[model samples]
Target chain A: MEHEKTQIERHTSKQFDVELEDVREQVLTMGGLVEQQIANGVKALIDGDSALGEDVARSDYKINTMEVAIDEACTKILARRQPQAGDLRLVLAIAKTITDLERIGDEAEKIGRMAVHLAGKDRPPSAFRQISQLGGHVRQMVRDSLDAFARMDTEAALAVAQHDAEVDREYEGVMRQCITFMMEDPRTIKHMLDVMWSVKALERIGDHATNISEYVVYLVGGRDVRHLSIEELEKEAARAISPRTGQ
Target chain B: MEHEKTQIERHTSKQFDVELEDVREQVLTMGGLVEQQIANGVKALIDGDSALGEDVARSDYKINTMEVAIDEACTKILARRQPQAGDLRLVLAIAKTITDLERIGDEAEKIGRMAVHLAGKDRPPSAFRQISQLGGHVRQMVRDSLDAFARMDTEAALAVAQHDAEVDREYEGVMRQCITFMMEDPRTIKHMLDVMWSVKALERIGDHATNISEYVVYLVGGRDVRHLSIEELEKEAARAISPRTGQ
Candidate 1:
């Protein structure tokens, strides 16, 4: 009878572990969708393709629905499993991560809107170099941040945080170049405005990705590095980002 | 024995209601703090109070913490109670509403950042009328949206959605004004750019507030009215706003 009771306990505990795994799988799935959306949205902007932008916009609704469904699923697990301490934190982190994912989807839609707006306008006479450079930086930030999340690399997350300041600097540069174009030729204001909006969206996407990276840091290290300076943050990031040699 | 079981169930069910009431109370408490932050952020902007703006920015961390706590509390209630149907929706809506509230807090901080950036410059030379109008409209939306949630007034929620168009229009107007300001006076360009950022933040807060209203409407009506027309939205808003005086 004691052996049977132990067997039942093991089965229930295994089931609880399975639920946590399920929650993680959902998060990674949603993360993949968001990553794809970011890539597609930026490509839409670069290629001047409204059709691709339309696709990105359509997928945002799925992210919204997924967030609701995932929240429900988590609540069910919490109710049935009655996870305490660390298990509870893991569930809470997943819930928070979904919110970040959904916001990333929203940022992608904003980029899509800009792409749709810019569909009719030609790139300005000479500001493409600066805009393209800024785009490159933003794309890199998004990529690195997501990679950090997937690998649970705190260093990468800290780098992502540092990258944001540079992205902001680049955005400021783009704004200045666009301002120059508008001042030089009034007709370009419309297109330049759209470009500025797209740049803003990319910057926001970078911010959200950094947020995901921050969450990974928190999950791994159990510390809040949100408001820390780049140098101090780098140590935590390094510790988190470095892969262990063995299990 | 069955009758004793029935009485116990009734007692627990009442306790469940009490728990739900606690969650709702905390949600509103958090919402009230967020609304005040938005108000203070904008007041900092209008009054050129950079210190106040900094205060708003610093306090955003507290808002984020409050949000996580509220979310955990709501999920715990949902899980422990295993609420069905309407109770489920109410809990879910509260969960969703907290996300909107957190985003609103972010928007408020964005406004504060813009305020600090614009502080070095003199007052807007471009009338600044639309931004002020939009600020008021969005503030009212935040205030009344929370009221609708507290009262479960679908009519008030609908009205909030209808007024989103006003916010959008104001955003467009700000866009144009900033573009023209850049074109007409290159000197005011930097300040106008910051002003546009402030207006953008306000526009988004209005959007989030409208989303909360939509949730309230859906929570009560159990229908998706996202694509509904402005006129129909206003009718629903009227009901939520007026509360008990419909006769």
Candidate 2:
């Protein structure tokens, strides 16, 4: 009887592991969808493709649906499996990660909306070159953050978090250029405001990605790195992964 | 022996209720702090009180600490008690609600930061009248959302959610006025941009408040009201609370 019970317990534990893995995979899938949204949203804006922008905006519902589905799965896991310690943290991190992902998706949709709004206006001479560059940088950050999450790599997470500062600087540069354009021609103010909104969305996307990286660190390093400096995060990550810690 | 077992189970369940109540109360306390932060942040900007703005920015750490502590407590409760059904949803909603509250606090900090940046600039004759009005509107939304959460009043939550549209309109008005100011005299571009940032932050705080009210609807109504229109949300809330449903 004892042997039989142990076998049953082992099988249940294995099933729980599978459930956790399934949730993590779903989160990655959702991240991929959001990344595509950001890319298409930015492309639509820079290329003045109203059809693509509308498509991108319409597709945001998919991300929102995934977020709700994934959150339900996590809640079910917590209720049924009663995850403890590391497992509990993993579930919690994924829950928080999806919220950020959903918000990133929202920002991308805002970019798409801005693109549609700007499509009717005359394109400026710079043609949003700076926005294109910043968009690429923010997109890379989102991808890298998801990569860190997929691998549960604390070092990679820290790197992505640190890269947000560069994204901020790029965002500021875009804003300055928009202001200059608006000043040069008062007629451009309305159009430039649309561009400003798009870049602001991209900048916010970078922040959401940084938030996801912080969750990765929290999951892998067992530390809440939300408000910490990059240097502080690095030290915490090192301590978490050190040989003496036996993590 | 059966009677004794029942008594012990009852005691455990009562303790669980106390734990849940404690977390809820803590969330309300945190909400109160965030509300104060928004008031002070906006007041600082409107009055050009650098000291007050600096204090609001500095005090954001308290909200962060509360968020971390509340999240940890929720995790512990989930691990130890494994609350089921309604209890589980309550815990999950609180978790999500606190995330929004923390973000609202972050927006208030941004407003405070912008205030500090603008204190050195020449105040425009209009003196941010639109921003002050929008600030008051958003602060009320935050308060009403928290009140709804505290009472689990779906009608109140829906009202707060609907009020966000007015906040958005106000935000747009401020943005348009800022553009006019910058266009009239390019020299004011820098200061106007600072004012614009503050208004943007206020707009986002309204969004965060809407998110919180949505959570209240989810928790009380047993439905994910996110991405739903106010009309649909009202229908869901009514159905969830209907006597025929026997909730």
Candidate 3:
């Protein structure tokens, strides 16, 4: 009877592991879709494709639905498996991650909506170039952050956080340029605001990407690294990866 | 022996309830601090009080620490008690709510930082009044959302969510007015941008508060009302509060 009980426990554990993997896969799938949404959303803006922008806005419903589904999955797993230690941390991190990802989708939709509004507006050529640069950087961060999460690569995650500062710099530069444009010609103010809001959305997308990276670090390292410097995060990552290290 | 086991189980359950309540109280305390921070941050901006702005920014560290502490408490309870059904839902909602609260703090800090930047910058006189009004509306939403959480009042939560639309409208009006100010005279561009960013932060604070309200509704109703229409949310809330009544 003891042996039978042991077998039952092992079977339950294996089932829990499968469920955990399912949750992880669902998150990755959502991340992938969001990445495309952001890339297309920004591209639509730079290229002045209102139809594509509308598509990005409409597709958001799908992401929201997926978020709810993933959230339910996490809650179910937490209740059924009663995950402890690392398992509990993984579930918690995944749950938090999907929330960020969902918000990223919302931000992207905002960008898309802005794009739709700006599609027919005549704007300075420099505006599109600046947006393209900022959007490209943020989109790369999103893609790489998702990669870091999938691989559970703490180093990659830390690198994403560091990249955020560069995005911030570019964002500020765009804002300054927009201000200059607005001041140079009163007629440019409205369009400049649109450009400004798009870049702001891009900047927020970078922040969300950084958030995802932080969650990756937490999940793999079992340490909360938020509000910590990159240097501190690096040291924590090293310590987490090698518990025997005295650092 | 069985009787002794039952008594021990009852004791453990009681202890768990205490721990859960402790987590709830900590979250409420954090929420209250964040609400104050938002008010102070915006007031500092409107009043041009750089010292107050700096204080608000510095105090964010305390909120951050409290957030981590509450998060740890939630995780500990989850792992130890493996609460089911309503208890588990409450813990999950509390965890999510604290994250939103922390972010609301961050938004307030952003506004505070902007306030510091705009300390002596001259802008149109109306900017401050508009900002104060927007800030007041958002702050009230934050307070009401917290009250809704404490009482598990879905009706109050729904009201907060409804108020967000008003906040959004005010935010757009501010943005438009700021654009007009910048357009009329090039000299006001820089300071107007500061005002725009501050109001943007306020808008996001409203969004976070709405998120909290949605969580409250979810906790009490056991249904995900996210992405639903206000009418639909009201219907769901009613159905949730009285499960036997058919919607």
Expressed as tens digits, the lDDT of each residue in A68-147 for candidate 3 is 99999999999899999989999999989999999999999998999899999886778678889889889899989989
Q: Which candidate number would show the highest TM-score if scored against the true structure?
A: 3
* Regions more than 4 Å wrong, model 1: A125-130, A136-156, A222-247, B1-26, B47-65, B68-96, B119-126, B214-247
Ranking by DockQ: 3, 2, 1
Each prediction's whole-model lDDT (CA): 0.77, 0.90, 0.90
Residue range with the least summed lDDT across 10 consecutive positions in model 2 chain B = B238-247
Every candidate's DockQ is 0.23, 0.70, 0.84
* Candidate with better lDDT, 1 vs 3: 3
- How does the DockQ of candidate 1 come out? 0.23
Q: What's the lDDT for residue A29 in model 1? A: 85
Off by more than 4 A, model 3? A243-247, B243-247
- For model 3, the local distance difference test gives 0.90
Best by DockQ: 3
lDDT tens digits by residue: candidate 2, B1-247: 9999999999999999999999999999999999999999998998888899999999999999999999989988988998998899999999998999999999999999988888777776564887889999999999999999889888888899889999999888888888888888887877788898888999999999999999988888777889888789889878766854574
TM-score of the first chain in candidate 1 relative to the native first chain: 0.86
Kindly report, for each predicted structure in the order presented, the TM-score of its chain A compared with the true chain A.
0.86, 0.96, 0.96
